[model samples]
Target: MKSIFDQRRERGGGTREAGPDRATVLSISSHVVRGAVGNRAVVFALESLGHQVWSVPTITLPWHPGHGAGTQIVPDDTAFEAVCRDLAGSPFALEIEAVITGYFASKAQVEASAGLIAALRRTNPDLVYCLDPVLGDEGRLYRPPEVLAAIRESLMPLANLATPNRFELEFLTGLGAHDNGDLIDAARTLGCPQVLVTSAFAMLSGSIGNLLVGERSAELAEHRLIANGPNGGGDLTAALYLARLLEGQSPEKALRLATASVFEIVARTARTGHNEMALQKEAASLSHPMAMVQMRTLAGAKKR
Candidate 1:
């Protein structure tokens, strides 16, 4: 199988430049100098889709923890809060139409981020806030309990959209989602206007699904499962989905495209035997993915 990188190279690096009318997005997440995860993945994906991104790092690491522990640098509370305050007061903050947050280093950082969101929303009442609670996966909590509490109590309510995996959803909701119905119930109960749950129950055998639950719609976008996919898939998904929505695509269309992009990039990365997501090499996939994604409409209940 031809790698996604090869296909992109064959097309002479099919990257789209941001247009003047593109909305500016603020992405606050962890930063790794050498890998495509956190802000690296999110910023690249948004830019590839012709959106400008203002990136802020909650923490800096040499690489993702999955690649083995490296240097982790988190700013002190005072310094972090200062920066957030500066951004909030800056005139440029009003230009940001959306904000996406992931992998906060501390509870203080989460609080500072919530403050920034509030400040921005004050200026732009329709600011889109996507909270991807990057707490943990596989039935474990990687962040401190306090960080989880801050995200749930302070950040979740402010979020217009949320992308939480099955494990993270369980951590946020304190309920066991044993099936799709349970997942839907938990998502609705979480109270986010739009919730996209990754790693949800796939109806098709040997497939993975991105289940989107909204006020009036429930849809699942499924693709073939790839083994040992690289990290940052969730980050990429959240970025692409948010970008699509900001571009005025319908929720279901955004879900399909985001799911296809992540699936294609992950499958390509696995084929190349890479430990990190090849987001830069697969920029074309982010903008114009050709991967096949099966989208289905499921029974949705009215929001309570």
Candidate 2:
């Protein structure tokens, strides 16, 4: 039987012989048993888009702490490194075309992930890595300073793209950006080929935007802001955006699609009065999002 990816490619008038039907992605992040945050959201979004996913949980939680305090478990640093080394040496390492890292519990986990990415790149030189800097939101840093430092020094340099929310971008750049233009400048300074800033300022009131900044161009995709939305929108956006890119979508299109998917799912979750995303019931939103997104080109910042 043809794989889901293969069937989708055929329907899209593509042949498997032209290229691989789908990419295999390694997702490293936190795991929650009762919520769709971190790897739970990332892995589901990727697989729903027809890509193969390998998930590694940096830490495990019974549920997101936003609900209340919960039990958390983090693997030993040495053991985490050992597992990463094992994957690096495995035959499947050559098959991974992309990796996304988020929410490391320790600086050591960040280092281990960096080592794994380096190893995978040796076999697949064109590997795409998206760093989702899961620092605190609302003008504070939730992660330890050392872990943030490791991400800035070690992982940022290795990433092809980065997905940071407005606050996290400020944390990474050490420069406060009050508007989209300032954000474009700060994003460029990160030196990543692509940076997608979520929670960007929207021209339309009561809406949110995702700003995609590149070397020479920028685009914004805006959608209605669901109030008190679920926790995994960033994870879903990063995963869906990467999946779209792997499927050969342009950056602007990927931004629109990803934004639409997240918005749609969040809207669904809100309507159902759920605190977590209704990803299991909203698979169609991930694969074929019908939500309308307002897309517009933005003026790139002048180079210094």
lDDT of 1 at 259: 96
What TM-score should be assigned to candidate 2? 0.93
For each candidate, the alpha-carbon lDDT, in order, equals: 0.87, 0.88
What digit string (tens of lDDT, one per residue) describes model 2 on residues 182-300? Answer: 99999999998889999999999999999999888899999998998888898889999888877867788889999999999999999999999999999899999999999999998
Measure candidate 1: CA RMSD. Answer: 7.4
Writing each residue's lDDT as its tens digit, candidate 1 over 1-304 gives: 4322223335443233434335688999999998899999999988888888999999899988888888889899999999999999997776777899999999999999999999999997767899999989998788998999999999999998999999999889987888777788889888888899999889999998999998767899999999998999999999998887777666889899999999999999999999898888887899899999999998865343
- Identify the candidate with maximal TM-score: 2
Tell how far residue 69 is off in model 1, in angstroms.
Answer: 1.4
- Can you list the residue pairs that collide in candidate 2? none
